[model samples]
Target: MTFGGTVLPEWKQRDTRPGAHPLRQSGHGQRFGGPCVKGLWRRAVVVGLALTVAACGRGGVDAKRIAAADGAEWLTYGRTYDEQRFSPLAQVNKDTVGKLGVAWWAEFDTDRGQEATPLVADGVLYTTTAWSKVYAFDARTGKQLWKYDPKVPGEAGFNACCDVVNRGVALWKGRLYVGTIDGRLIALDARTGAVAWDVQTTDRTKPYTITGAPRVVKGKVLIGNGGAEYGVRGYVSAYDADSGKLAWRFYTTPNPKGAPDGAASDRVFRDKASATWSDGVWKESGGGGTVWDAITYDPKLDLVFIGVGNGAPWNHKLRSGGKGDNLFLSSIVALRPETGEYVWHYQTTPGESWDYTATQHIMLADLNIGGVERRVVMQAPKNGFFYVLDARTGALISADKYVPVDWAERIDLSTGRPVEAPSARYRDGGISQQASSPLGGHNWQPMAFSPREGLVYVPAMRNRGFYADALGFKFIPGAWNTGLTRAQAGPNTPSPKPATPPLATGELIAWDPVARKARWTLALPAAWTSGVLATEGGLVFHAAGNAFTAYDANDGKALWSYDAGANVIAPATTYAIDGEQYVALMVGVGGAPMGGDQPRRPGRLLVFKLGGTVKPPPYPAAVAMPPLDLAAATPSKGDADRGAALFGQFCGACHRIGGLLPVLPRSPAILDGEGFKAIVLDGALKANGMAPFRRYFDEAGAEDIRAFLLWQAKQPAPAPKPGGASHG
Candidate 1:
């Protein structure tokens, strides 16, 4: 039977003898005594074969199957429960990598960042884009099979501290799980991309958001949230994979009233965590500690390791009266997967300030250390420390500084605590410059570990920050509660004089966990680049600026490179189909700190293999921003200050003074009040991904923002320092 305007060739039959008798024809149908019977039999056979193929295509990816994945498929965020992000397939190794070229490319509709790590399983490729849009494609070809958009409200953009981004999705039995930026966890049919179950994972009334990928452990989907800077308590929730029912929750911080939350973390909070806080202010500030990223499950140990975030107000004096270890903040906490009960924890940054979050990357491996094989959990947290801990007990095995940092002298191995520098806190109200800025030596980029080489490939950063207490700090609801003035915590400004030599750049570091030192370093053109991918083929791949390059796994030597026409902030994943291996990555810009200065471009999924020859579409040239005309407005400092605050609330997430987005002080549109209104209030630039903020700001507010931009334009440009700092 033909359906949907397409002919079903298999269903058609040819008759002999001029159709003398349908049953008498010399065909298989004749043996059945009628053409109708034959047709039904043939159809049944076809349907049976189709069902068999479909079943084979959707392999069951349970915990047991994932544990035995063997890198032939990209089954999870890190390809396995260990989150090693390493592949055993090595067909396209260092020798053949030089001939790698694009095999197929699929462009996305959105121009925002593409931070997803595509999951490849059963010959299907699944990934997510900005705004939590999920898609599935044929692994061998670039044919799109299905797509799912959660239809998140546009107004929800305000809740995101960074650009609206969804890290990726999780695959369970026959469902694909994703955490939306608006704080919803959704499960989709693996074949059809239809919503199977949907659950709101966070309080909608608060500013909580979810930009990380969901992880399924022991039949439950685990998800955490962001927005510690907006005054909400942080927690990680688990939902039943089949019914979407809340299984349990573990709050990362203590309650304000000292009452039990009646959740899995109640006892731990009441007994261990609550006392670590200085009651009054922490109760009010939610104490930060958002478990926004880096969740890994150890199937053997049955423990879930959650990497916690920084403090709420950042400044200790403001968040916790300048005291307290802040129990879970900036720490790696181990929890029971089934019950969400706290097991043990290791604090990476005690009394965490300076946005030194432990939520960078986590991997598990068995390593030979000091003449013994150790089961360890490895992490390169933001505070410039690389730590190895016993995954089962959460005991610190070794800690070392992987990057140059001045905040603390070193981590004391005896006590597993940092020996803080006296001047690191900036408590005396003077501007204190700190190495390894709040952006972190390493951020959300996933690192790769190669058991063959015994080295972890890290995307490392080098930057500095200036922290100072704000004048008259007061909590502002629905806004950044950093407790520091904008000038102090704002974008990085060049130092007038050198306290130390500048050190801001990006590099791919091959780190030896045993030796605690870098083996070799490959300098990147820019910081905040994409994650790393290690293959058994002796190749390591990474994306930076607009180029995706592959290097020798043992030594940092460039083997192949491709200019993808846009910045790639996502890691690359490799999978095999029909006995051939392929590497895939999403290309675009506009995440947290990078790509704001670069022109917004449509996102694309690019795949590569040896001798493949498909070219990516050319990206549009960046538009030259018009210069600001300060002669247009003469507003008072009070109006300018108000405008600055409004700008922070609205524009600061994407646009900084010298970052990727168009700098307001240099934009010629700000020279004309009407033009500025057209862009901001009337959506003149909506086509370019700048959504109209008419509902949030009126003409008066727009004018105030314009006045502030004009005031900023009159000031001298800060001198460029050797090192650069970008937002996370």
Candidate 2:
């Protein structure tokens, strides 16, 4: 049985965990023992942690300093509160970029998705890797200072909708905050990786995940969760940074009981959002609408923006009885940061049925439209539309398709709704449609905006969707709850091969949010790509497949390129130390590792500078797997067919044939039936993320799944590329 690796039991840990909160450097210019260090000496020493006596104001990366958008420090997740992801540093501009080469690189121990955006402050670069691990590095030389692993129970891996990846961490007064995949929000002392406060944020019994990074607004740390696909209610929460106490929470969906949840969102959910959802599978599946990603804070408006995810059962008819527009699902909502009070919202996909989640990316900007300067909040959600909305009131300023969207012909500006095609819902019948499917016109990859050029760089995609409802669907707790037929479910399925293959292509679009259109587009041979990074130096950086490249932000010109040695799903970030600008990217593969031969590469931090030369360590060669013998017990007539259906429903989400998880055909367990039954049917390997399937299947079912793998092993296919999974 599996024993270690982030899977520790802490179900009873519901209260705030107290720890040391020593004074830290804010870097805002106060003396060594000034007002910043006046009176916190006793508190610092009490917790057995050494305290620093440096410049401290409110003692953290406060609102004013972040608003300055300094060139040296990348304090916040998106560099600043606006989430523009545009670095102001220009030492390595277009004219000097040709000399750009690798300065330093750091490889992570975990070999899953590297989605974290490294946060740099005062010359220290901090980032998180898979399995909710955090690390601190020297920005200039890439020296590792410390690493902390949450040790989230490996069984919690069953709860993750995507791979076990973390977006990064949030920094506060001398502390770094991270949310674990198993629903714990923890704060670590920045100077020394020691626990300050730890709080369990969700019902441990339910399938809830916190893959997204935490954000700090005012004195509270804000975080949301994933697992809408599994059965759980969604909410964005706030905790006191110093004490780790619960401040408030805002549920994205409503309580079916129609009673107040005693939450900050009680009033709005009761009067507005509660009416839209009906009471069937919706109630059973917790009526999904998790705020998995895209939480932005607007200091000017004093509002926190949250992008909400898809409904629990993605099929609208199945979730809400095919009736009212699910008010908050697939929406961008505004909330008062202090009290979690609801302000206003703009739903991107009304009654969303096609997994068109609005929780892609939300960026705040000031745009000039029709001779007026407007403070706008923009998003290019999963449904293929680019939206520009009034930041203060959530008014629809503009909405238009940025990709080929057949689900909706156009957005009705007058009504602020999509003029959806009738056949798009599959209400007439289960049909295949050519559009941007759950692969999304865009997924969770972070986009970047250049205020200097008035453009938002979007890593856009196009795909086809085949939607069909699962007949006689039963609500399974903490399992794949999308109510989709097995054929259309799992990573193995996206769209069938069409006679024409335009949808398979991806692109980088220089999108003009004000014009509601693409200013320029760069088509890519591969549809799966990485997040974008824009710079004031007239450049945009992103990784397509394994090649990381930089392009001119104004006209989309490829200026520099490097072989990242693997797929990079995370966005690139730029920061400067000692007057030199550096671009750092986290590289790995996860989500849905696009099918094909993949090269095995380590999760890495690759940094670049204008005139520095450093080479990353060579990747270990991919090992070839011996062909499966399957000489033990044989399969029955229909065992392979039954196993094919069963694997897609259960195993396919993680154990893709050529992805991150174990490639079962070559796995030793395939040759050991008794061992396979122990691991699959019994709870033998439950600690290693192989959760017991006895709850859903029997020994015979386990054998059937094995039969299906043996059948696959017997088939002829491409030599295992043995590498990347193009995922989150």
Candidate 3:
């Protein structure tokens, strides 16, 4: 069995840390001495953003509008700058929720993932779909006003580590801004859908893709990208809202050259961050700390909180020689929005290895703990820990496991560090972590906070990430370099089966952030689930499988349910137009995690209201897969075995049978070597997002992969993998 990092040649490590604690029992969690925090030393007053807005008119999205969390419109990504995602509107209360019905619907052309949260302003509803297309609708009648397409090159689809999905768009001073999946940030006239300005956010040559929604703060548009797993460095950028000029940039990882980048983050890297790393492929990969999603702004404290993602070539030793804390990877960092200056940072997973991104949703709140009022920033990260930090000082107020955590015993509050389990590093031998996997317990999906219920609603899951590394690990420039061998991901056992982390499952957790524990839990039925929406109506809205359900905020009782008739992975939003309140969400088959071969439904925006009586049209019939050739030569067992291994490495990511791209098992392109070479090794389908794999494998290897799929196609589909459980 290959221990992921330690088994590599030319590897050496030392435990310079003091609190390397032992592992804990399987599913339960224990807390250490978590100290109560004092007020922040520096309490900056709100500036730049005046608390003024015309909610009914075109006031545009400002701090005042976002912070108000008004009922008329969803002005920003999280409804408010605090990112609480809690709607103060209560028209559809528990008593009235039974009358909620679909008012109207709008459909799109693409079948890619639907994750964007719609924004409503001036009686117009604005949202985005897959491929960075933007749309506007009559908030009251669902009339399509205008739609704008960035026309992202189809081949740019290959650059996305996930599906080519756009979370949503941002509105600033009569202009709507969207960051394309191809890395272009463009601003458009909100009324006419005309282009105002467009700027390239990243070097188009690299594998960077923007999946997060842009946040406008103090006349600057803040945006981030995702591509860490594909070997790109991570950073958050700010642009002048009116001119599309570069405002500032804060790089999460240190510069590759070990010299000043002449950027805003250069000073911090030289003083503290640069030393935490040792020479390795990370320097080349920039060590991956992308602010892929979840950027929250606090006008009171004048800080922008950005959640940072995992490292490149994810195995710690493989990335950084198992060196220092790997400053900023899997960490929560607070920055000055105007200049992108670093204020303070809290590392969640030091020396992050399991793709445990601190880049999940971060919501800000004020809580009374032991009668002491403290302003806190909270997150339920992939590592399965619920962290509550003093928002201003970055001090840990308290931390506890909201889910089963086997990686570390608990967080030592005094040191602001986890008492990580000793064997977790796998330095001495191979081991499996029951709960913490690359698909974190809590992924990038946004969580909702209920000020009324005093609980944080989280979509939590337990996914077993196989940790054994490949035999002769090498970093590929634009590929998933997490160190797991293709054989490990296959159905066959690469190592002995692991225990404690049971089969994959998911639940909706109502956590008490102040008390640092789960208040209540609701077991969900789908392998895939949507982000949550909590409202003052004493109700919480969420989607599981195709059934969207509403639950009582105080208790976990199911209040009402609706049939969505398609998979929905985006969070729900609430708004009021012309005295009528509406709840809406985006629905379409998304990501491979919904298990393979989902129904083919067109992407759609669904709006609901009390007493509304409209039904979305049924989906078109699914196309059947063609049968395989009966006259083809039967492959020798050796040929098929080699094909399975190669397929696991090169093809399994998107081409699983009955999966996201369900045209693989009986693929016509693989019927002959000539066709296989063109489609697999050449750029025949590159426009369709299937980039030629010639960089990683040649024609012979592609033929072997073809043989493997033919073999899988001849039989019933294998049991669905747990990978789709939750990566949001």
Candidate 4:
């Protein structure tokens, strides 16, 4: 039989034929056409066949298909190249949303954060879990089809600045590409969950990791790494989809040694970026500009844009002797996807000392500006500013503060830089409090754009940080490289006694980009809320605290909500199966800022549709920590200062004075040396997601930690300040 000019061998004839067509044969088949065709004919036929296969393999997510997604499927990370994350599906509209309930829920093994946005195509749902694990399920029924675990090393968890979380995976050509936390990019056979090819994208020895999802453009899988806090240079690399060979790499920062690294970024760095640096100490610590998140591809313009991270040793004074714009540190750069050539860049935070990363979310759209329709790229970066730029020419169209900010009064449209406040730099050895902490006005939580409403939905944060220089800055081998001390940044300190505290708050703001004003704002109980998803149903979905709530997209009126029983930090996605629309999101909260004191429950993927009848499990009750009697107990007699250092190194990552996990100072077990030894050395809490530190701590070391906890328990808590820093 002939199908689309390609011969399909008959079953009976295949057994009798001596040399059957390679496509019909078993065991490692040859390229589509058989050896029967030769020379020019073979080449032409193969090219044609390849194009056909490519079109089919795109599986409802090709450029044309995504542009016209029509709400039946979610093909790409943002549902389209524009990354608007808005769905046209209205099956569960405002009137019917009140009837929405859980359609199905799938629990994951790891309890770490689940920050992925699932991709639905051809009735299959694809998502990633903690530690870069991928899973596929039936979109309608929620039956697990297959699961793939890259088995990333347990120790690699330390390299991740946040918890061991993976944002998502990319689907292309019948394959799913995922970047493991240990810096490896693996492509899997989408149907069988089998490994297709694996390539290490970063140096295993360095503190580099890949928590962000991969994006595919022009038959190339592009991936970037994280670890700016751990002191590593950052770059984004593209690999051939079929062969897993390196195609090109674009480094975000320049070589520290005043020499070219012979990379795609060399020419641009030397010509445009080198002058922005003062050299010296920055060369030792690779200038941190990790492109951990936010890669968008514009097929119409044929350009790929990446949001670059903050600088290493966050204090610009320490990192670069308090000078230079530090080109590309906090910027959005456009590049040629095929050859990785530089196009143009707009630095969001020049001399980014406050950890104001430009790597938040990038959305593309055509908006009427000054009565003229302009192609624009929009972003609300960490510095608390909403910016609109010419997507084609990289020109600043307009920018305004989307949230409260003191670091800079406003963005200067003429120079494309911020008009810094007098005390914003904090270079005189005095503490400077600034709005929009290191966590940013927005973090990795994605924002959504609605062309129908002409508004951008932002998960806006109101937070601040106190920045003070660490007098004698020293780089730790594999620890956080911020030149500011932990306590000075304001939240990662140990407190023994209780104190009244000012709270940080978050809000969902619908802002008109052209007008630079918010249409409406819905205040959340807590700061650091989840991302937003707007639907044609006249409803917007967002996860705050323990509920997934739907609000009227235009008026911000509460429409409906479901208790997810777990804190959610990932964005919600919508798709349709068999003419029915379903809204899906991952539920788990364990990132840096939301870690301590926040609930630590099992991760779950919850799906909902109108009139669905599945009920979610009840939320776990808060665990009350037992009272401590450290004064009545025998002292461990260890060096309290040494113990304090150890606690900061080991326990500070997850534990806080009043967080989701038990507060160390108030825990009775830590007050008792033997009890501490049992939990830390005997792995008593290993089953509950705590790692056994037996390999790193001995009996004496455990007692030292106990001593520190005892000392901390006796001290008075510092006065809580509003808008204090909280890592995300």
Candidate 5:
């Protein structure tokens, strides 16, 4: 998620995302119009009339100008400076939220995922699509206003770890700012979509990419890079909003000369550098720290907070000497917004070896803890701990295990350290099973904080994984490995066997931050990925797998539930216009490591509203399969019989012959005959984990396999079984 950063755990070099562009700002120099006047006597008469109207509340100074006293419009990244992902407008209260529906939706004219939250202001919604192209639309009607493409290089896709989606843009003064995937930040004129200024955040030749939205605070535009998975050092920087001049830079990890060279404030990083990181690990691991998450700011405290991502290579022994806190690797940092000076920091995981990054949520709130009122920074790190710390001083008030975790027994409150397990640390050549899995207890989708409910709701998954050592670990181009066993498949490969775990259902937990306890919990049939959103009407909205539901925030009562018919993986948001409220979210099942494995077909975006009758959207167009020549293989009765016998012998472990089924790499429906032939005949199948069928079957034997496959496909879909059967 971070830009210009190295990959985790092992510090192996990685390729960066392309399309991240440079940013700039525009000022209020043009006077469009103002009040008109005549002579003093005439002005006096007009003033008297104005005073009368003002007294009636119709002619007072516009309150829109007053609201700007803090910050104008949610133009940057994730709404406002704090990135709370919460809106102050209460017009769309729970009472009337049932009427929420899509006024209109812009499909963006592309199949790229809609990960970006639209920046709304001045009746226009500004946002970026996949590959970092910016677009503006009339907020009320979803009419296209303007679109700007940064022309990111084509090869940039190779550097992206996930899909080529941009989270959003930042707005300052009258200009729009965005970071491209290919290591540049650009600023555009809000009125015309014209480029004003652009700057390179880093050299793309090093394989860095930018997917995070740039944040704007005061008069500075701030941004971070992502490539920790690609082995790049991470940093956060500020630039003059109007001129794009570099203001200051803060590197996440300590470097040679102790601090950044040639800066007055560099001395602050002295002495503490070596204390936080072990010797030789920095040079070997490349100090992986990518701050891909959005930054939050509190004007009252004059502080900015950012959630830092996990370390590189994801195998800690290779990154550290089994010692050192690794400085700020998996920590939330508090710094002076104006000076970029580090005030204090709380590391979520010290000497983190399990890729459990503390970089998920950054929620700011005022709570009463232990009879004392305190301003706090709250987070549910991937490591499975819920931490509540004093916002001003970084003092740990409470730390609790929020999920099924065995890596650490408890957090020592006095010393702020974890009670580690002997096998928790990864051994270079030994295999170990760790609880809370590499997915952590949670991932980056984001959680919701309801001030009224005094609760935080998170979509949680419980998983377990095993890590085994691999030899000759080095950064290789176009290669991805954590210096660990491939597939987490089993203790061995090639002659591999399936191992099962106690898979559990996903849960929606409503946590009381003040009490530090779960008020209530509800379990789902499958893993949940969407975050929760609470409204003034006392309803909490969330989606998991194929279901989207609303619950009473007071208790975990399900108020309304709907089978959305698709997996809801992205986070959700709400907004209102012209006294009517609306709820918006994107739902689909394809992207990343999980996408290819998920079963849902057809991606979609569904908008729901109460009392409003709207027809469902048409499904995505079906892809056409190319023609296949099966006759070229030449099949005889003997060959067919032999192929079927061979399939039964080698693939029957995971494949079922009837009710009937085919032994295909993917689902039977996703492939045609030709596709199946290529997979069986070419070695590409085995290269990516699917075993090679040609090893034991001849051309004639392959015909028998094809016959069975066709017969399976032509059979009617199976009836719903009363009891679910497990398949490995």
Candidate 6:
């Protein structure tokens, strides 16, 4: 069962080894020197860069006038660059943000999973963790100034279909750039984290991981890869921010011997659309369109937007080996941050079979709406709506349902389509359901937008999930639920759940893009997936589960909170160094499939500010766990009648072996025995993509799978008997 790239060689935490190599440039891609040849090769320009320097577009700067509006120093990744996580640094507004505090903190000795976003400048902070490593800290006393790793390739965490985590870093000139869950693109040296150039942005043998964050602009850097669920092919490159090279790519799907924006009127189905997916399911379904997270960057429209993801075995009738509309997948696109071309696209789920993904957060602004300043580009997309568009012609100036959608009962706006909801698709034994499921009522986080509280906060999550087929599934190169086939366990299973008068939790809302509505909406004890920043006095900042808060962006009330004990993962940034204003976040409670009960492994790295005398710093230690072979470990069970006939011949559409099946198991990190012996002997937990039991167990069939998961967590939990019921 350890399927994806297998590597639990005792949780191999760190062994990087590649340091000081620098000094290249000679015969750059040579032709005169033999061994390489591009356009007859060429190389000569040396050194050059410095002019009080400033070139690289894409919302690149303007932290409200170059890091000033209250400055505490949070360089990028939505802090600015039109990513608009907003932050005009209001020295702890909402009336002294309830005396804010905790001034320091920075514990990430690495249990692997932080999904970064720290990057302060001058006072020094930078982020990036879980498999991509990268640190740097010291932003006002958190200390520990250097870390870097890059070791990626313990089979690239089985090309992470999700969660080997990383999302942070990117500075420019003095250097930093990141991208490398094994797709490479390094750089570093922003005053000594070392390794100046690494390259190789894609082709992790075609698996690609790069968990987001890497924008740099002007002199290039960009990035964008994450196997839209282990089925690759979803470009966006652009390098050379100073010797990394490669320069341009684009390609969000379309090319079958044509694509410069293919068209039949909006890229009309583009060349046989993955030839309807059956035979060899496109090299084991390796074409899902993975641009991982938001990439923003408008520098007054030098473009570079990007979002696109989803379009793999999320059953678009089995990867379009049928249906159609597969065009630039869950799209948004835009491009041209210096030749990555493509320039435009909107799509947002066109032949998309429910994993609906516009990769989440994007922001960018200008607004004034009916008064007409225009330029916008908001986004909430996990298909539950909240759009806004018109960022210079992607059109659709409005879209609603900030949450709980029963699969689009309204979104027609003269013809943007959506009417949807016939129980939301997937036939056969009937089980459909749908309403922002696919763990998305907003996926990937980051969603602010304040210009002194005009609104738009959102952290969202109304939750719902159901759908099937993988008929014979297939594609298994580098695995992680690859290609498919794994849905058994059926029996008395009932579990339909989530419908308690529709308040299934998670919020932060806000809205008001020039009076489009909802300016307030609190709720939150769990389910936020991080994001929210706003500032300039009224306040907003955010973080849940392990606490850290601040609100009142004009009445959601509650200004200031603390705790930082767990959960609250990522997105919460502010800045303003000299004149004071620091906020910073990126805390991870677990590799999120959802985070509520907290504590999974060490994981911490908070950073607040607003006086009462700072403090924090001194936690970083818990990263030293490797010695459990216990001479060939032990924990087995091998046959609940052959694991219920191999989970009903192959895992019944998205897991549910619970009181013995009905399904819809939202990754409780695979319910235990050390997460089932690291999902059967660890290929780094199938390279972070899960679903790996080393191709069906074998160390005594994973000790009879720890006695069938201690006879399935000691059974129980399945009572609630009532009308719509069957009591498995």
Give residue 173's lDDT in candidate 3 (0 to 100).
80
lDDT of 3 at 677: 71
Question: Which runs of model 6 end up more than 4 angstroms from their true locations?
Answer: 1-85, 90-313, 318-321, 324-347, 353-356, 362-372, 375-377, 380-388, 391-443, 447-568, 573-586, 591-607, 610-613, 630-728
TM-score per prediction, in order, is 0.87, 0.88, 0.88, 0.86, 0.74, 0.30
Q: List the global CA lDDT of all models.
A: 0.78, 0.78, 0.77, 0.78, 0.60, 0.61
Score candidate 5 by TM-score against the native: 0.74
Worst 10 residues of 6 by lDDT: 44-53
Task: Estimate, for each residue in 198-288, the C-alpha lDDT of model 2 and write its tens digit.
Answer: 9999999898999999999999999999898888888999999999999999998888667788999899977878888776688888888
Clashes per model (N, Cα, C within 3 A)? 7, 13, 9, 6, 55, 58
Full-model lDDT, candidate 4: 0.78
Off by over 4 Å in 5: 1-82, 88-97, 256-260, 263-265, 279-281, 488-505, 525-528, 561-566, 589-611, 621-728
Using alpha carbons, what is the TM-score of model 3? 0.88
Per-residue lDDT value at 496 in model 4: 29
lDDT (Cα, tens digit) per residue for candidate 6, span 233-281: 6777777787887766766665433334332222333344444334324
- Comparison by lDDT, 4 against 6, better one: 4
Candidate 4 C-alpha lDDT tens digits along 1-728: 44456564332122233433211222222222322222223223222433443345355345555554545678789988889998866657676788787899999887777889999876789999987899999988999999999988676776777777898988886788999988999999888789999999998878899989899898899999999877898899999998999999999887877788777899998788888988545677788899999999988899999999999978899888889999889999999999899999999999989889988889999898899989889999989989999999899988998889988898889999889999888664556677777777888899999776888999988876667666677776566677765551112443222122324778899999988999999888767678889987677899787778999888999999878776788999997654357899998875223323334577899998766898877756666434567667767777666666566655765566523345677667775677778788887775454556776668877787777777777777654433322434
**What root-mean-square deviation over C-alphas does model 1 reach?**
10.5
Scored against the true structure, residue 351 in model 2 reaches a CA lDDT of 90
The reply for model 2, stretches above 4 Å from the true place, is 1-58, 488-503, 590-599, 622-626, 630-638, 658-660, 665-668, 683-687, 715-726
Better candidate by TM-score, 4 or 6: 4
